[model samples]
Target: MQFTAKFNALAVAVVAAMVSQVAASPAPVASVVSTDEFLKWLDTTDADITYIGKPINGSVPRAAQDVMVTYCNKRTQNVCGGTCTVYNGPAACLAAGGTACLSATANVGFCDRGGCGGSCNQLSTCGTHLDNGFCFTPGTASIIVPPS
Candidate 1:
């Protein structure tokens, strides 16, 4: 009976170790930002945009009915190249006139270490990173609107 108990404990320990390793692994970097993250980014200033983790390439915007953003992609490999805005989705950002915000280009990727395209030399701010996108700031007010 004692041997059986010991075996059970050992098995549990092994399982626990395996679980911890899986949890620690990085999440598959998103292809796009979630709706909630996009909305939050709108209200955030340039200094804090990285808080929700960078948006991965090919992410779809979740702007609301009146939100807008300016996206730029120097690489030109994706449609989100240059400035754009969110249109409709989980967090669609609409304009004050009730027009939809511009959707980010379909091909843009989040600016990460690898995606910077080796042009880090000229960057004083994030502009050196060609893939970076910015939500137009003094962003839309922080009004609590229901999700679409």
Candidate 2:
């Protein structure tokens, strides 16, 4: 019947629209940075680093390092200091330790010593922080990969 034919045509049009919408949507992306790149940035900025959402430079090396250690739960503590290395996320870096590590792809909180925490990711919040006491802030200067 004509009614059946028209219904089928409407269904086809709906499917096509759905397909177009999916294609038009932006692809999911994560920003990843190498340890070497982060270290270079740290050197240039002297631990005065900040990101897109965070107001002021987030150069708290101790906080970042502690979180990485807890997430990775590594027996050794060599990854935090000396030489630049790549890190995927806090958990991956903590467990692997200086071996081109990767982190949780999504849905994670970055916790500080006093329990101050924030969300983290590859592109927006991906990177390490350092505090070497050279910047003259308080403790050590923190370094992090600047958000893109």
Candidate 3:
């Protein structure tokens, strides 16, 4: 009887701790980044990336509808000066192939990194770089409406 009572008390304490943890967790944030800001931010991050393709019409968040990001997924092979290199992903592939890849392509879709999450890289403040945080999708991201 005493053991049962202690077990129940421990369970209650565990449940209370879980509830408090959930309540203390922070919420997700979203935004729409601008072009000029992106360009400047690009210089800051100095990421090795290039335009791969466009985003497919998947369901976009209402707040994010005005702007959407379509990351590319191009994996192919390239012969750089007789040295063949298997390219994996459009951005990296393009950067490797350089001008030679501008006219070529492979395949693309929404870039899902199994990451924690994603959000918009608003102007004035640049978000994370491609692959690391913000730029999860690798394709081209255009603003449906100018940054507000």
Judging by TM-score against the true structure, name the best candidate.
Answer: 3
- Model 2 ranges with Cα > 4 A deviation: 27-109, 114-148
What TM-score against the true fold does each predicted structure earn?
0.26, 0.24, 0.29
Model 3 CA deviation exceeding 4 Å by range: 30-43, 46-132, 136-141, 144-148
> TM-score for model 1?
0.26
Candidate with better lDDT, 1 vs 3? 1
Off by over 4 Å in 1: 1-9, 16-31, 45-70, 74-82, 89-148
Scored against the true structure, residue 30 in model 3 reaches a CA lDDT of 33
Candidate 3, residues 6-94, lDDT tens digits: the string is: 99999999999999998896632332334333334334543245433343222432333223222223413421112212221223212
lDDT of 2 by residue, 1-148 (tens): 9999999999999999999998896754333233334445445532222222222233543223222111222112223222332233323212122222222223232332122223223323434422321111111112232212
Q: Candidate 1's residue-wise lDDT over 74-144, tens digit each?
A: 12332222233333323332232211111232222222123233222211122222223332211122211
Model 3 TM-score? 0.29
User: All models: lDDT?
Assistant: 0.33, 0.31, 0.30
Local lDDT at 69 for model 3 = 28
User: Where's the lowest-lDDT run of ten residues in candidate 3?
Assistant: 97-106
TM-score: which is higher, 1 or 2? 1
RMSD of each: 14.4, 14.9, 14.1
Ranking by TM-score: 3, 1, 2
